[model samples]
Target: MAVPGHKLDRMFNPEVVAVVGDKGPGYMWLRNNLPFKEKGGRLYSVQLDEKEIPGIEALGIQNFKSMADIPEPIDYALVAVPRQVSPYVLKDLIANKANGAGFFTSGFAETGEELGVKLQTQLTEMAREASFNLVGPNCMGLYLPKVGVRFNADAPVADDGKIGFLSQSGTHGIMFSLVSAANGMHVSRCASFGNAVVLDVSDYLEYLMLDDETEVIGMYVEGVKNGRRFFETLREACKRKPVIVWKGGQTEAGARATMSHTGSLAAPQAVWDGMMRQCGAITTNNLDETIDVMKLLLNAKRPTGTGMALLAQTGGQSVSITDAFSKAGLRVPRFSDGTYTELGEFFNIVGGSFQNPLDMAGTIQGSMDTLDRILRILDADPNVDAMAMELSAMFAARQWKGKPETLDKTIEEIALHKERSKKPFLVILHPAHEAEYVASIQPKFHAANIPLFQSFERAAAAFARVLGGGGRARTRTGVVGLALETQPR
Candidate 1:
């Protein structure tokens, strides 16, 4: 196979891969159950010591010690060997011109010892010389839906190409994948560069920016290994794709050791704030929004700025959303009298409630058509930047029950109405036995870029990061299936 200059891509998106590990009980299960090998990806098991694991011989297992012996130049390699032994095996890879590698082995630089640091530095130097991009020095590696490449060592998820995720921690990567699947967000590319040795978060990010399989790029960072490079990547990424980040270890201890993690320079609060302001990067302190922002950007169009109109089945949900948005520096952007009259009683269109939160389109039960029209009108009016949609099960009760298609059609109508106006919209649904409810609405609202948030907090945090205007949002067109439009509704 032709070797591309960038190898991390193969690890994240590989058609052929080799797992260089002992065929133990766990490794065997990983081979059979993990997403990558199951997708009929060309796989080879390079067994060294035990030699004879059941069924290994049939799948083209060779006594071959390294990539040189395989005859086939592999695109990706998962190094799950022991911590002490991994460096030696990785050298063999560098010798053979291996494109990219993922280190599942732990106990490296994280140990914070001099020898460990030396070991990490050596690997980084080797990777540069060999031209092999690396993803994890201590990560679970990457998980991709299309190629079935998963290092999660767990269950399969509904593969929708929406958010392109990158993490500096493997555990966090797994958490995001599982939670994203739970929240009706699908994964296209998920990579965790544990102790990002040669290719840290920024390298994979650069690749994702050019990748067609990604849409929204998300990152989790303990510290950026290279601040200048990271800044450049973040600025570029935010312009094209929405980049949401969660900065880990923000306390004093973390600040002290920032240099050790990624050679990061701990800036004073004012400097850090100024840096983020210059870049388009949306940095978050919250973990939930760390994953949520990517999902939000994946589902929703960018609002014309944070001016919004609130719509809800219940008054309280509206108030909550309103208060939060206002606190986040977003505006309800006062409504016109004609706009208030439109919802009628839904806003109590007659009473004093005719405010930006619109209090009562004055009606108790909102018709699907009425709801759709009202949302579209607010979205259309120049007064609002986006609509704060608070949906409850009660809104769907009288009209949307039994007729499952009714809900779909109603959502479709709302989405279609918002489409022509090209305005961003938000959906806040009450939670209760919601795994399936979220799953059901996913396919419908996907194309429209409306992320149905798991929690309002997640939504608010993510929204603030994007619209804060301090950091630019980046878009990745190279991501393969960003637009998940199932047509003919």
Candidate 2:
């Protein structure tokens, strides 16, 4: 599907790309790092410097003396030239009929200088006249792995991914892309539309809605070009797919920083909250929470109701999980007599509580035999809409340090239960051991499509978010539908 206001093909899947101002070491490093040359997209180094530019020829990039001298159609240009000469370089690019341009050079509106602002305006105006999009005057630019385009050298390039990310800050965009990859959420496209002179957040959201590859969108927005249009677009996108927003510039000091950083007028926190609530979009304050929310959407089943049945190894953790769920407006209801009778067969009353937020100290510590039965029972229970289990894999690893086989068996059981369970199941893995231990088990859990978190609070919060702001327990009527509008506060 064709995206509006931006020919994303040229913006991302360009046939031929030119990197202007390739004289310096920075551009050389970037050119060396671009992995797309071997992956179908042809790359060219446009350098006016006839002098010997070190390390240019070795990369096998087609070098050109000028934009017009390239002698081929230029789909997109990454202009890294100085602010003073950017206009002239852009003019040359337009003359060559380049479809889109991403200005990696800063010193535009962000500099708070009239000349910089004027130059930025001129560039966008020229792009508009040319009937293509201007991505940024101060950004890292696109990272669409499907077509072999990326801004950072080390960013992961997946054949296909589901996340569609758009960020106002270039650094934040890189962070989200990398972090999402680490958490097993692959990104389809990431655009850092710095200063957003031409293509803003609203346009990107619309494009993501139409893109078949994107199932979820994670946005890092500081400001918007049009508030009403953005809100309406956000509402529409939410109806189609999950839209996770991380609005920076919430504090007074942060607002000042955002203005200087992206030349954006950060809206008030109250207004931002209202928009998110009205649009049925999830709010993530930081990158970790963003990943947390995305992980829930990608891995877990959409909840039919807010009734949660938490099973924890430790009594303290059980209490904490219940508190967190309560604070988030989710319910931790009592188990039915039938469930209690069945649970009694495996759980000896000596060490655990069978009530809601079931403390499975004895069962967790002793028996792996009852694990599947426990999961199946919880899933079948009419009172339990969702389930959360705290598994201390790190502690278990420590106890069975030499027995990697035992650990694997335990994880395998959890994975098997996750596949068979009808209700949404959340596994909270407490990283109580060294980084290596946690790392070893994370991939296994991720492989099983089980949502894993380091703490109960985070897990509970994710469950609550899935429950649409969780309140009193609601019965599982059917598959939970997406929240179409914000419930009044």
Top TM-score hit: 2
In lDDT terms, which candidate is top? 2
TM-score of each: 0.82, 0.91
Off by over 4 Å in 1: 1-13, 32-35, 55-68, 155-160, 254-270, 341-354, 361-366, 394-406, 432-449, 454-457, 470-489
Error (Å) of candidate 2 at residue 23 is: 4.6
Model 1, 55-136: lDDT tens digits are 4655444335555777767777777787767778788777766677778876666677777667777777777777777766
Candidate 2: tens digits of C-alpha lDDT, residues 1-489: 235455666566677877878665556434533777777777888876766344566567767777888877787778788998988988888888887777888998888899988888888887777876778879977887766677787688787689999999889999998888877778898888898887888888888988878888989998887776787788788878888889899999999998899888877787677667666788888988888888888887778888899988867877988998888788888888899889887776676887888888677664577777787878888898888888766467666577767767777887778777777888888777566778766887787777889887887777777556222232322211222222110
Q: How far is candidate 2 from the true structure (C-alpha RMSD, Å)?
A: 5.3
Per-prediction CA RMSD (Å): 7.7, 5.3
Error of 2 at 109 (Å): 1.2
Off by over 4 Å in 2: 1-6, 23-29, 52-54, 365-367, 469-489
